[model samples]
Target: MKAYLDIETSSDGRITVVGMYRPSKDLKQLVLPNITSQEILDFLNDAEAIVTYNGDRFDLPVIYKHLGLDLMGCFKSLDLMYDCWEHNLYGGLKKVEKKLGIHRDLPDMNGYDAVKLWSKYETRSDRKALEVLLKYNEEDVLNLCILEELLKAKKVED
Candidate 1:
């Protein structure tokens, strides 16, 4: 099975949430203080391939540095950013996503906002901030699936 993944990190590089979405499964967000490295591994244990926008450079390395889990070493990785580059598309995930007409529920959201949200939740014990952060991550992981399908259809058409 393919796993679509994204991660949200604090400005200081601490991981606040690990968002993982597998097709036909509920979106899972492993929030801080409640997550173990093994739990993250177990969630990804059955994945034969991993799909992400710029995972090779950002997500995968972060996962490795933080959790010491070499997911790329364990599973095949398909970085959609490279696919976009081949199609003459450029920029980060949200930019490429917009170029391809992929819809997002939280368009105004970005990595900076994610960090701020985490800060709010962490410092003030704000549940609403955490909820919004989770929802933002949910959109990020789920949209990756849509983006991959669209890219595949484009490949077939060309």
Candidate 2:
């Protein structure tokens, strides 16, 4: 019931992926139909909790606007960005990795970089933007497990 979700979207409201993760296996990436509101909602309707990094402000609202529906429903949400910030856990993901002593070195390309990638594609009709976006999106969702573990450990120590 703990669903880790992340999204890759275009500036024009087209969703590229609604990446979903389960603990038993590697995270599964699902491509959403182009700009279809209902399909997106259907994908998200049954989660017991949705966990994301900075999703409360960014990702969820983007999907909400597309769906013409409110996401403030029964499912609980944990925004890792806000949680980390609230607890004075500064530093980007790399910093967190150092502080938490996690050894994995993640890619430097982030959501902002994705915007730039899209811009590049817009000019030259290149597909690298989508490629970068997909890789970045997958990384974001994959890290959710590590983050949740770190947070829970912090809670236990407190």
Candidate 3:
């Protein structure tokens, strides 16, 4: 099985949420401080490979830093950002999404907005902010799956 993963973090590197997507399965968003490392490991157990945009440098490291789960070399991974670079595609996920005509409900939201949403939840106890952040994260992980399909198709053509 293949899984797509993404994470949202606070300014100080605290992981606020971790999102995962698998085809034919419900998308998952694990809210931090309430989530367990074993839960994540269990979810990842059947995944033969994980796909992410910049996961090698960011998501995986943050997961290890916060959850004490070092998945860097243990699992097979496809970093879409690196794959894009090798294929001469530049820019971040949003940019690539736009170029590929990938549509999002919250097209205006980005990583910085995720931080703000977390801050709003932390400072004002805004559940709505957290909800929106989870929605954004869900979209991110889902998009990774879409991008992985596109990349794999492109590889076949090449």
Candidate 4:
């Protein structure tokens, strides 16, 4: 099984959320206050491969640094960002999504905005901010699957 993953962090680089999406299971998010290494490991227990956009450089490292989960050591990792490069697609995930015409409900939101949303939830106890942050993360996780499919479908001849 393949797992698609994404994470959100605070301004200081502390992990606030870890989102994992598997085609076979309901999306699972490990949010701060309740986020734990065991939960993430368990969620990914059956995964033979983990897919992400820039996971090799970002998501995986953040996970290891924060959770000590070492996902790449446990599972085959396929970073779609490299695949995107082979097809001449460049830029961050959002930029790549826009280039491919992938729809985003929170189209204007970015990682910086994610940090602010987390701050709002933590400092002001705003559930709505947390909700939006979760939704934004949910997109990052779900869209990995879409991006993977589209990348796989691309032809070198094009």
Clashing pairs in 3: none
lDDT (Cα atoms) of all candidates against the true structure: 0.89, 0.68, 0.86, 0.93
Model 2 scores a TM of 0.74
Question: Mind giving the per-residue lDDT tens digits that candidate 4 earns over 48-127?
Answer: 99999899999999989877888889999999999999999999999999999999999999999999999999999999
The model with the greater TM-score, 1 or 4, is: 4
TM-score, candidate number 1: 0.96
Number of backbone clashes in candidate 4: 0
- Candidate 1 local lDDT, residue 138: 91
RMSD of each: 1.0, 3.2, 1.3, 1.1
Backbone clashes in model 2, listed as residue pairs: none
The sequence of per-residue lDDT tens digits that candidate 2 reaches over residues 1-158 is 66777877666656557776766445666654454556445655566778887778766787677665555454588788776776678866656656776554335665567666656766686787667666777777878888878888887887
Error of 4 at 46 (Å): 1.5
Question: Residue 20: error of model 1 in Å?
Answer: 0.7
Error of 1 at 113 (Å): 0.5
Higher-scoring candidate on TM-score, 1 or 2 = 1
Worst 10 residues of 1 by lDDT: 33-42
lDDT value, candidate 1, whole model:
0.89
